[model samples]
Target: MKKKYKERSARFRFWRNIAMFLPGVIVAFLIGFVGSDHPIEFQKLFDRDMLYIGSIILYLIIFGIASTYLFSSRQSYQMMEATEDEDEAYRYESQTRRIYDLATIFKGVMIVPYLLVIFFSCQKLIYEEKLTGILGKYTIPLTFLGLLLLTFGLEHQFRKTFKQIYGKAIPRNSSGAEVRELIMSMMDEAEKQICYEENFDIVFKLSNYVLPISLMAIFLVGITFQTDILLALVVVSLIYVYILVSQYKITKRYYKE
Candidate 1:
């Protein structure tokens, strides 16, 4: 029975992954095929003047939704804290988890608008052939700074909630080693195995597929836009470094084992 259930689950997951992946593949194919003959007027569709405004609006919307989730999680946590009943606490705990999971999705979603802002800002600079003024000069740097702040704020809230739930504080100034130690200390062997498996999946997918595809896309964009080869090389270099680092970590772990 267990084996049958596992097989069924695996089959379902395979189909689900295919379903999620096929649309992107189809869309890319259609775009490349059609665009070769009938090119898109992206400039007309996405005016430089309005790109920044549109990105800002999108960012605000994402921020609002993320905040709503986080706020709901906090409220659930507070309810759990206030309650003495075991049943009530468990209910609130589950509610908090659901809300936090939604909040976590936004952590990835937030990157889209941030990337759009950077892309549009770079496009503006490239076309103009110079920084138009103070805004142009500082736009990329400011967007980066904003992204950094938003990431830090979200992570801080997440850590605070984690501490509240676990009754253990992870120090703000903890080094990477220290943070890993603290996190590992909180996990059982089974939980640690699950975490390791999930991380390995991420590393495997990134190294095997994401990096190569990203490198190809970067070069294609560079060729299409007539952007500097140096810019593409820099991105390629970063991707290579990530792959190397991941390989080193994996090797070190297996070698020790």
Candidate 2:
């Protein structure tokens, strides 16, 4: 049984490594395909020098994905198996909270450009100008680059925190496994209780539908009025503003002051 589980784990890791690199390769291929004047032209570009550049890019992407996987594996170990010490667990929890805050900040920061994309896309559709060029030429690539940099920084933070909490002496007892499972179950229940009491589930579910419906309405109005795209975008931004404000209040209520 143990051998079979280990084999399955190894297989999972093998597929995960390939899945990580595949997205980068697909994105690069799509960009080449879309930017090429003709299919033959794009095909010809993949010769000796270009193949070397592509190989280098592929290696760099694989290196990045491998780095992320290593850090994430360390983080998983810290969360699940390495939190035996009380002081280490406390520090890990504190770091986890800060990481959550960092994630919120990252999402909040990214929302600006996302809203801008909506406004600009609508603006271009309404006014029929050269705004799509800015989006296609700069926004997409820069956003992708930004996410890669952010991922690197986040992994570094996790690595630093994990190293600080990592202990050499792991206490093994007959009841340790059972106790760990009980503790994890209790923590999961507590998190679920908090979410239920806070009505987070309702808010998220509502937002899931409301955001898309609001955006769709805005787009429809833009198509109708032809000059009211900016106005519609303004209305949509206001909806997001309300959502953000409500989220701020909820966070303030739930989190430490």
Could you tell me how far off, in angstroms, the CA of residue 211 lies in candidate 2 after the best superposition? 4.2
- Model 2, TM vs. native: 0.28
The TM-scores of all predictions, comma-separated, are 0.61, 0.28
lDDT against the true structure, per candidate, is: 0.75, 0.53
lDDT of 2 at 199: 72
1-257 per-residue lDDT for model 2 (tens digits) = 11333445888979987886575557555655655443233234444334433443543454455445445445644684466887777776656544543443443344444444444434434554432444654654564465567555654654454344343222234277864554345456666676465676566765765665576566544443333468767777787678767887768889966
Best by TM-score: 1
Q: What is the lDDT of residue 255 in candidate 1?
A: 95
